[model samples]
Target: MSEYDDDFAEQGQAVYEALLARTGEAAPQPRLEPTRRVLDLLGDPQRAFPIIHLTGTNGKTSTSRLIESILRAYGLRTGLFTSPHLVSFNERIVLDGEPISNEALARNWDDIRPYVEMVDAELAEAGNEPLTFFEVLTVLAYASFADAPIDVGVIEVGMGGEWDSTNVADAQIAVFTPIDLDHVARLGSTIAEIARTKAGIIKPAATVVTAAQHPDALAEIRKAAERDEAVVIAQDVDFELTADHVAVGGQVISVRGRAGEYTDLYLPLYGDHQGQNAAVAIAVVETFLGDGSQPLGNDPLVEGLSEVTSPGRLQLVGIEPTVLVDAAHNPHGARSLAAALDKYFDFAETVFVLGVLGDKDAEGILSVLAPIAARIHITASSSSRSIPVDELAERAAAITVPGLVHAFDSAEDAVFAAREWANEGTSRLVVVTGSVVLAGEILDLAEAEEWKKA
Candidate 1:
């Protein structure tokens, strides 16, 4: 196992251990008290840096990464906080373009530990429970960002935006990547309801930028923005991705937009969805800089878009059998993945290793990929919300297709089984997706094996 200096490791370990002990305290009720308490105890460190709060069912993570990179390119110290780290917990906290170092973790944990303890004691006395996993991590992220002296921080909501812990920060700018019908049981059952939940992140007079496609979702967001007196900029109305030209081994992309036409805009991500995301990022920069009475120039905009890279979105891990991983946990994301897969890959047949959370529409995701996949291997993710393996298999079987279908107890086993089928000396493709949690666990196992090789 990798080892660090005992002192630093001890501090980091303490933070996680405390969090572990507090898990399963109670099902999270929609309350903002825990987040507000943490912020108050820390002197509201979130306000120390200007923030761009992003929330949506899908595209939020990619959009946040794009904005952070663009801001950093404009020569600002940028902090990016996202969730469900693909490989390590450190991936959730990035300063500039790098993950938080062990030194940073040690320092931030030491600073926040006292406040966390105080909150724990207060909760106990009040007959309340300790902070949840996401709440504590939210506090840590804000503390780390403030300590880094970041000029700007892009925060992605971990779940529904309204009462989510990250909502404590009143964003100078609020960006909605696109709202859809996922997390229905928690957020609400309709797109409008989901959009309303996300729109709660907006604060008074904050500038709102969105790529929300559904008219109902946009209307709800516009309503919230109007109520809060926030400025709302919708993608189709305010900006657009006119065209995109990507070259071989080239990170630069050529795009034309409503603001102005720019060439060689470099973004180190794949898919046409990225082209749309780039437009939103540009609008955010314009919103922030334009508020200063001096509009942002094309030079900074170009530089910013050119430097953004989000890992695990069609992330290519190896050649020969061609392993790719994406966190397409919902129908919106699944459709995007299917589009990208169709555009970039052409195999004789395709094999899919799929698993999903219980709360997800497993059938919907399976339907999206049904046309392209030659075989489907269903399995359960390593999360508490994972759908039962047998249940997922039954759902997949119900989907009509000529493709072969099977099920397994775990993602690791399903992946291995799919790998064997794909490596049968034919031109077959393998895709592992369905849930972010599943993707993370699969990636973790792959990296563990890779480390063993080294």
Candidate 2:
């Protein structure tokens, strides 16, 4: 723990322990009614804050972070609620551009714990199991934001948007980042089907910003927005990314264009796809600020993306032997990761540390990632959804590649194994990718190790 963590570590641990004891099982399937009951009991705190709802298969977290930073830069006290936090649960909830402090978190839990208990009692009375882990977390986030008295909240959907617990909020702006085939079991098998599922967050009369390029995705979203009469802004049509170039230092940088041009804009994220993400973020901010209700101007836009930082989204953590951590779970995200690795770190003999949830299309993702990886390190992430380490190893072994493939029980072991396999003094690149839960655990472990050193 840092000095800051040292000060509040006990309180934080207590709160986390309480939360863990209350909701221990992390089930994949989510029911809506328990969450609905919890929010209703809390008097719907989600409605108290203005919301920007974002849903998609990829770039949701990064886009949500960008939106939060931009909104905060505009001088508004902002609350950001994203999922599968890389380091801490507090990382999932940010107020005024900062992670909710342990002190504040304890206080909020104290205030909300009663409500949580009441909801649990009510659910029991209704002959139902208690609220699931995510439902409670969503309720906690809303309560935290409400207690903070934020001007606006940027919320990212955990899975498919419809019936998602986060979709409980009334959003003034809805963002859809590149939808693709990922969750076929729950969402759908085809792009159009998944697009329809994700389009559920676009409230009537709200402004919708999307980076969907597929005809199926665009058509589905367009129809949904048209039916709702929502104003829709899309990439390559309303706005665009221009002048993208990577510096020798490996920063994937670019400029965005709205009605006019955004010059010298630098996003520390990698991949050509991030240009679209930045563009979508800029468009969403422009719309929200121009709404005349909450005026966020160009200064915030310039400062926010320029200074913004996030972990495990094409994040390069170490030098010499370049090590990157990206939580690209789905095929769309895998393609983007593969492209980024090809573009910026192509010179290095790349080793990919890979794993996936059982529900995800692991083979499809591997197909996208295999071309760029000179070696593959397969490992099981620390989630119930995780595919077994042996299963992952089997999949990697099946792939026809001219490189090494190995599996391990944990991501750390895989990391170490990759490092050992890397060419001597060649500046080899090791990328930890696959499931978000896996990536987040690896990131948390890495950060904890770094903290110990400090």
Candidate 3:
């Protein structure tokens, strides 16, 4: 566990692990009342600071982190909470640009355990299930943020917005990345419905920043913003990636924000989509800091975005084999990842290491990657819901060219095989993707081995 699990605070990692074992998003909490009750028990800590709330199918975490980094650069003490942590549970609650310490995490949980147990007992008496894993984590994050007394909280919803556990707190600025047809079975079948569900965080008179979205998604978001009387700033209309070019380690892009045009900004990230993400983040911060009237000066904005890093999104993990790890689970995300791979790297042969959850559109994801991948190594992630490697390999073969699919029972073996294939002097690149779980597992392996990129 790399001292993550070892230095388990006074309570040890066992209790936290037990908490993690609870029902996850697979079992939905239909209402936000349970989370509200828990927060009420904890003295409504979400009210302790202002929040910049964000939600979407993909890029929510990235956008949220960017916003946090920018706000921190502006001298705001920050509390950031993003979901489905790549490697550590501690990643979900970051303060001042660092994940909450293990001691603090355990102590915060201990401080709230009695209150949570009280609520659990009350719910049991009422014949209803207790607060869930995410619900508890949300509570813990809110409490921890309050304890930190941060100047701002950048919160990303755990799931759909309206009823998400994190929605108990009203967002002063509601930001959305691209809304797509992910989690359709849970959110809704149609893009409009999903957008409506995500629009739940837009409070009255809030400033809303949204990425360029599908016509239907845009319509839904517009309707929500109008209903709330929010001042809306959308991509392509209110802001844009005016120009971008690939630099040595990242990209440089200029965005015309809601308030003013900022030029010659350096973003140390990949993809035009990330530049687009930078635009949305800039607009959100403009709305918050500039009141949509005047842009913040260039120095802070430049440094903030330049220093921003989104782990597991088009990240280079190792070299010689040239391993890349990205958590692009859905078709939309996969397409973006594929395009970024094409743009940022030159590989004679690219082998994709893929794993997918059973709930995702595995076929769609594979189809998107098929155009770019020379071969695919299918593997299962740590998720219990992951599609079997053999099944994924079979599906990938159907979508990809014949005889280019291989299956590994675990992500580790899959990575080993991909690296071996790359090492055969084929100018090869290995990309580990298809699910965040797989990315997390592979990244942990890379860190353990101290693999350096070529």
Candidate 4:
């Protein structure tokens, strides 16, 4: 690497470490004033461009990416911010369609560090905690977007909508993917309560686009939209996924959008849920570009969906044993992953390399995934929050058949053993799942090991 490249990488790493020093995302504060204060100090850069905000239990990242890609396909300069990055911290703040360059990430952090410290000092005087990891990250994103002078920003809520750090910005369009019973401790125990919290993202007179939600969840969203006087273009009402057929590398889907019927749009992602997400993305773009009245022509729709990519969502990492990795940390996501495996692949036998975070519902995830597994090799990711391998294995053993669960100390060992076992049979597959951290670790390993080459 060049000296400038090395220095830029070092600066980026320094900024990441500084953010890591704050309270982590696992324990987000249920307040937004701190984020607002810092942004105010930075002259509210979030106001520089229009924003499309997204929140929900699952598929938020995929739906957000889809929206950003379509917007970029239409020749608009787009900024996308999503949380719980799979690999790099830079991944969370995207400019146009690429992760923000390391130089820009570091430069933005430099520009905002003084304002962040001012907020920290003010909070300390008031006997309150300082800004959090997500709060500072959100500020950096807005500042970077403003500096880039993007035409629009697509921001995903790091957690519950109302108090999430990203809520400091009023969005032109609010989008919700499927709401479910994940993050019960932080969001809510019941679907209605969780949905109520997520519904907080809707702003006055804004346009809302949502996937098909549970009745209770839908009711809560409707209540919020009523209060905000927002127009909701919901799935199965204003638009729907007309058809989804499995195809090579992804699937072909047709959507009846609010503006018009779009057919045979090939989405390069797996599962019926992805098709639903695409429909929501289409509606969001319609609401953004044409007030939900004019059809997005076939060019942008085709080019956007064809090039869209959602890493770690039923993504293939290896070929000889057909290894796939998915970030299904919760039951809602696990259900989707399991269904995709069943529908998209024709393996005679499957082995899962599983690791989950302590806060996640490991039992629920295992119950949903175990039914389709020939064997499960339990492991843990590098996160301090990861559940221990022994605990996860015991949980799996209690719910699965005898001799179907095995424990390993690391994800590498578990995946190695699973691959060896898969090689023993003629139509066998290996899957790594349970947590986003695990998915990222295995993705890095796969890249280094050249797992895609036979």
Candidate 5:
């Protein structure tokens, strides 16, 4: 699609390596100054297109993808940026509902390299660390969208909203997936605090779409909306997932949108939370394209939702023992993953391959998963932050039956063991969960071995 040759995997790999070398997203900079400066020098590319920004504790990626897909179905040129890729860095930045080509990625990075360095120089000159990994990527995403000259953009924040690099631009519309206690060390120790912090993305007069929240969390968002005079279309009020039942390939749902009701929409993703996510996504599109008084035509709505996929979220990546992977690194996410499994599958038992990060609530995750897991296979993922399997297993064993907890040094070994255990019977399933890095690693391993072809 460009002047460059098609063999650009090498270029993509180089870009990924360079990004990994930067101050990583794990070490988030709690300010947007560096990102602002970078964008300022790059002619503020974020201003080149309208945006629908999303932030929350979970479901943001799925919701963003839904909105982007719906827009593309309507024949709109769209750009989407989400975080914590499952397999490749290129997955994070999408154009026209597809991952940006490696050639385009390399070309965009080169075009903005000088300005990124300029911002890095300014920060270093002030005795500060250079831009953290996500900051630079945020700039790259915005710049790429400007070059693509997209009609709209759907951007998901990498973490807490107030100081996240992606907050540098004011979105025309802001969406929040459910907010829960997460990133307590960085955002805050309470739901209200985290809600307020994430609510920072709601710009003045921007229409806000949100899920039902804890009372205190709702108050914080409402307060922010009043301050900004933004309109809040909330779940169970402005919109709702009226019904969802298990169906082939995934599930079918009926959503009452802001202005209209959409029913029998077959979403390829599982779980009730995803149903609610689809509802919010539909509202966002309704607000974007038309009033709530009329719903989207059946063709685009059905086709988009039917084709939608939330990779690494309850995704069945292997067969024979039914290996599934989900990027449910937090307690809330773990709960959703567990519920989806129970609601969608009739497996008599399940073996879990879990590896949690250091900062996450391991006990909280185990508390939810251990109750349903037939056995626990603990292992270490590629992240430096992954908890040791021995330590993780000790914690997991306390919740699961004695002699049911096992440990492996690597994710591949853990998957192997889990699959072997699952093969004991057809009613058994193996699920890999707990961290984004672990999910990505498992997918990578599965592909290398020709495990299931996704």
Candidate 6:
């Protein structure tokens, strides 16, 4: 690598370490004042551009990326900010479809560090905790996007919608993707409670686009929109996924968008849920660009969906023995992964390398996956919050046959053993899943160890 690249890497790492020194994402502060304070000092960069804000239990990142891709296809410079990046910190921030350059990330961090410190002092004096990792990161993203002067910002909520750090921005378009029970601890236990928390993103007179939701969740969202007098365009109602067929790399889908019907769109992503997300994204774009009345040009729609990619969501990383990685951390996401595996692949036997965070429902995830897994190698990711391997194995054994469960101290060892087991069979597949952190680790290992070359 060139000296410039090396210097950029170093500076980026420094910024990451500085952010790590603050409170982490797992224990996010459920207040927006700190973020709003920093933004106020930064001239409210979030207000500089109109935002398309998204919040839900699942598919938020993919839906956010889909919206950004379609907007970029329409020749608009877009800014995308999503949470808990699979690989790099830079992955969380995208400018015009590319991960922010390391130089730009460092420069933006430097520019905002002083204001962040000022907020920290104010909070300290007020007997409150300073800004968190997510809070500061949100400030940096808004500042960077304002500096870029993006045409629109596609911002995903860091946690629940109402008080989430990203919610400080008044979005012109509010999007929802399949509300379910995931973060029961922080958000809420029931679907209704969770949906109410998520519905906090809806702004006054905004255009709301939602995927098909459970009755309780849908009711909460409708109530919020009604209060705000926002127009609600819902899936299976105003818009729908008319048809989806399994294809070579992904699937071909037809969506009846709010403005028009889009047919024969080649989306290079797996799962029926993704087709639903595409429908929602199309509606969001339709609402954003034309108040849900004008049809998007066919070229932009086709090209946008064709190029859309959601990495670590049923992503294929290896050949010959065929290895895949998915970031399905919760049961809701795991159910989608299992369904996609059944519909998309023809494997006779499947070996799983499963690791989960402590807060996640390991039993729920295993219940969904164990029915399809030939053997599950239990392990933990490098995250401090990861469940211990032995504890997870015990839980898995209760859900499935004891003979079908194996434990390992590390993800790498578990994956090595799972790959070896899969290699012995003709139509066997290997999958790494259960946590986004584990997915990111295996993805990095896949690149470093050249898993594809095998």
Residue-level lDDT of model 4, residues 284-315, one tens digit each, is 99999999879999998899999999988999
lDDT of 1 at 431: 80
**Candidate number that wins on lDDT, 1 or 5:** 5
- Consecutive 10-residue window with the lowest summed lDDT within model 1: 249-258
Instruction: Name the better of 1 and 4 by TM-score.
Output: 4
lDDT over C-alpha atoms for residue 319 of model 4: 92
* Candidate 2: tens digits of C-alpha lDDT, residues 1-454: 2357557877877877776665543344356777777778778888897899999888888888888887777788899988877767778888887788888888887877887889789878988777666777788899999988999889998889887888878898989998888778888889999999889998899888888568999898899999999988888887777667885543544444444566766677777787678878878888777752333355667788876776788886655456778988878888888887777666557888998988888888888878767788889877877899998788777874644677788888998777666636485787888887777776776665562232
Clashes of each: 1, 0, 0, 0, 1, 0
lDDT of 6 by residue, 1-454 (tens): 2345566998888889999999999999999999999999989999999999999999999999999999999999999999898888888989999888888889999999999999999999999999999999999999999998799999999988999999999998899999999889988999999999999999999988999999999999999999999989899999999999999999999998888989989999999989989999999999999998899999998988988899999999987789999999999999999999999999999999999999999999999999898999999999999999989998899879769999999999999898888888789999999999999999999889898999
TM-score of each: 0.92, 0.91, 0.97, 0.98, 0.97, 0.99
Instruction: Give the whole-model CA lDDT for all candidates, comma-separated.
Output: 0.79, 0.79, 0.88, 0.93, 0.89, 0.93
Which pairs clash in model 6? none
Q: Residues 1-454, candidate 3: write the lDDT tens digits.
A: 2366456654535556857677776776867888899889888999999999999998999999899999989999999999888987788899999988877787788888898889889989999988889888899999999988899999999889999999999889999899999888889999999999999999999988889999999899989999999877888987888999998888989888878888888999998889888888998888888688887888899889988999999998998778989999999999899889889888888989989999999999988887777778889998999998778788887777787788888789889998998999778999999889889998899989877844
How many backbone clashes are present in model 6? Answer: 0
| 215-261 per-residue lDDT for model 5 (tens digits) | 98889999999999998888898888899999987889998887777
**Candidate 1 lDDT tens digits, 205-288:** 998988846999999999999999998887877777766655443345554444555666666677778878888877787676
Q: Candidate 1: where are CA atoms >4 Å away?
A: 1-10, 24-27, 249-258, 292-303, 448-454
C-alpha lDDT (0 to 100) for residue 119 of candidate 3: 87
- Candidate 2 residue 370 Cα shift, in angstroms, is 1.9
Which regions of candidate 5 fall more than 4 Å away from where they truly are?
1-6, 291-293
